[model samples]
Target: MEFTDHPTGKRLAALSLAALGVVFGDIGTSPLYALRECFHGEYGIAVTPENVLGVLSLIFWSLMLIVSFKYLTMVLRADHDGEGGVLALTTLVKPRKENMTRGAWFLVILGLFAACLLYGDGMITPAISVLSAVEGLGHITPLFKPYILHITLAILISLFLLQRHGTAKVGTLFGPVILIWMASLALIGLHQVVRTPSVLAAVLPWHGLHFLIANKLHGFVVLGAVFLVATGAEAIYADLGHFGRRPIRLTWFLVALPALLLNYFGQGAHLLSTPQDAFHPFYAIVPRWAIIPMVILATMATIVASQAVITGAFSLTSQAVQLGYLPRLRVTHTSASHKGQIYVAPVNWLLMVCTVGLVLGFRTSSRLAAAYGVAVTASMLVTATLFYIVMRKRWEWKLPVAAGLTALFFTVDFSFFAANMTKITHGAWFPLVIALLVLVVMLTWERGGEILAERARGLTKPLDEFLKGIADDPPKRVPGQAVFLTRSHNTVPVAMIQNLRHNKVLHSEVYFLNIRTEQIPRVPNFEKIELERFGSGIHRIIAHFGYMEEPTVALIFTLCRDKGVNVDMNTASFFLGREKLTIGTPPAMARWRSSLYLFLSRNGMDPAAFFDIPSEQVIEVGARLQI
Candidate 1:
């Protein structure tokens, strides 16, 4: 792995600040209404001092355990290529099995399903965050109540409109605004805390435990509310590669976490001092003069939060393509300098449409919140399971220690998942719909690839026989040396053999390059391109790479030479078979689904970008196939 120093002298601060804006924005904004909705929602709570403080205590400690301990502190370090998230973490942790076991495959499918769920959460975060912030207007002035829908729609439209531009461009303003938002939360809540000093007792963390133990009947319900605070915690892991662990950890511990806890405590204190304000304590703590500005600032914070999630979805899709779970989608480099910063038009539009629907359908932030946490919780739970396997198999830790850690998380997660299940009837399907769609696409891609590979293997000739025939009748016209990238095992690619036979063109040395995905994500960099002599100046080059890493043709060719494979990059041309699929009867995919894959393939990432191949030297040979 290549590690570079901070981009500038101020890089530590700048990256930390940017991470605060991008990574924590979604989770950070949870305080806007996490508690209010907790008290007011189906949990059936009153504006009493104990209930508010108890719930506030739960919120604070939940963040400490789930976000701080379980994820930020521990899981962020389990990054794959500086990337963290369920999928990235999965790429890091997949264990070797002698054969595919039902349990192992079950876990794989579950984790993928969890990833699909995040797309749902991605759409919901913006909808709920924006709506909740806009809803704050009702507290400031009653006249704003009737126009809430219009105001929300307008704000949402503006938010979606701003997305064409990358977050890095407008990110300079995010930190200051989030800083102010957190400061105001602390200030407002602190004022109320001073008014009712006893409210500080809620910080003991035991009150949260007692709430669960004493109120066994409704503990699960309260957990549903508590989970909201940690809704976007997975983003921290998913976006880990965007900003390293040090800066993100520092930002959270030194800045974001403190602000959130203080404000949550402050809000609790205010509720105890004036029960009436519990109806809208976040705003009630503020002065009339400050309420409007607070609303505006909150709106900005929510928009930023939503933007981070949107960007995360884009990154996840890119990873999916490289890993072969999904067919390639057109990936436009959003920043020429950063390979990580990319834009997928289909994803952007899909998220935009779903978000707009959420804003319109829910119409209120509180309603959207019900559907939000399920996906995030499921995603975190999946990460925990994957990490547990890593600790045991890769890290070779004692099984008890890993199981204990995983159990703690699973207990909390399962409880929350069950709680959220109560909400399945109330518009949770929006996310489930997106998850199902992505699952189908991913599974179809895998199945289709398998069927196609089996078909190719059956149809292709043996390597020894084909090469023997080639030696007997050598072609006259030729390039100095040529390498053909192929999927056919052992034998030469059908196209290359066919081209040599018909065009009568042959190189002094013909290299067959076959790239394969291994079970693990990291192979020694030195072992990149393996070579074998097939005689007659013909060598087979099998390049090995972990999906987490990029495939650079020049670098691979260089590694081949270093490994004693006779190949020259400047004189060699790369031949990539472009398999054009025409839909036909295949048990792997239905007609409509096959159509979708074909359409997605046509619109997918350009081969040049996907393979990191230079366009001038890269040649695409069209191969027609029915899958």
Candidate 2:
């Protein structure tokens, strides 16, 4: 499937709207709670005119500098090929030295953690976005307040259940629904802006500066809530693969940004006239007749935002598996034409359980707000750190220029992260804990795999020496071909060796195939396969792929055919080795980690299934691996 990274004409127009539905959905829904959280959440500031304008000013500039300039302009340029995100960034930026230095390893760790925190963002987004939207009922009547939790749980459960179906059929509605949602924000806010024209003064940068000074420490802390408006800014960079820079930038500048600012100013205008509405400023500005309809529209918008984050998680996990940060899991591609549209059942079920637990535990969007910004800000800060290196090491920019730009991004991000850090005791620990858990699992899998591979490589005999031994001894050759999958190209596969030792027979044609996922996103078809004949009936095959791609048995055969090596797929049998891991003294890690890796290895998808080999034609040989 080919994607027009740079689309023009109707393609661009369609994608721009599609970007609104997916890319901007989370940030777009911020109007539901961003302002109200400033004065209504656990940290309630007084709703005085000075404070109102001050918070408004912060929201405006944060969106401009952070979302508009930093992400859309700066970070998007650091994409791996056309892919963006911290994981993708890890592939693009390299160490100056051939060997990864300590500093380079630290940056890699930062990227992995950033990727982990994004999972936190993914989980929290649905809980808060949908809850905030559903909270609109409280304003309608005190009578409906009792049902909010039940109603939210229903919506969330329904959302996760629908994930298996893919969004392709209902995706068309996303653009139109969000279009109305955006238009409503602008139209609704435009009316209030006209009424209290004084609110327009919030756009000036000085009011934000003054508010910080007047409030002192209090104002600084206010950043935690104010940062909520920019919660989904990372999604723009994350979703660059779906809608490229032009459409996302164009939509933000033209549609989503304007509507957000207008609505926010309108909320400020209404609050100035009625400070009592600070508790729910967003819905307060709505006319009585329009409130119910607005809630319906807002609910739809949040659902889409939640769906986008969930799908993004699936994509991220797929990348992690290919990159060896995780054990392979079953990934279901839901869309026939789109490779990116994937569904992972374990991920879906796990997220559903956690997100539902969040609603039950937090009980309200305002409380969940306590947990939102910390993960997101931490992620953004990590991304900025990696982006700095890309500009310096990858792009070859002047040292001072790289340092200056990085510092600038750090200043803004650090402010938010520091502020969010203060809320750790107040529920922000939820995402941090999640991030830590994910980090341990990811690091353990990677480190454990390295040790296992090293040990396996040491045990393997050279292909030439093994072939000569077989040629000299002449093990009885059988009919048809046999393929052995190996982790290392230079070493003989364990399955083949075990087969020879036990069965004492060889196939007429033998293939020692090794598939390695490179740090890059996609290996070109021309450079994918490396085949060498070893003078007997043995062939060595090495296939390379990027983390973003999946390898298939058919592709390997096709590449072999192109390289003048004929393959008889119908007559070939593939052999896979399943490791039964045992814990050795120290075991390359702690006992706990060894057990975890073993569990993952045991439960992981079979290679035959993961690589698209025919199940009937595949045989599994189990070997004990003491780590």
Each candidate's lDDT (Cα)? Answer: 0.76, 0.89
Q: Tell me how far the alpha carbon of residue 303 in candidate 2 is from the true structure, in angstroms, after superposition.
A: 0.3
Task: List, residue by residue over 98-174, the lDDT tens digit for candidate 1.
Answer: 65677777777877888888789878888888888888889877999998888877877776666666655676677
- Candidate that would win on TM-score: 2
Give the C-alpha lDDT of model 2. Answer: 0.89
What's the residue-level lDDT of 479 in candidate 1? 50
- Could you list the CA RMSD of all candidates, in the order they appear? 3.5, 1.5
Query: lDDT, candidate 1, residue 121?
Result: 84
Give me the overall lDDT of model 1: 0.76
Model 1 segments more than 4 A misplaced:
1-11, 96-99, 209-219, 462-464, 479-483, 507-511, 515-575, 578-599, 602-609, 612-624
Which residue runs does candidate 2 get wrong by more than 4 Å? Answer: 1-5, 94-98
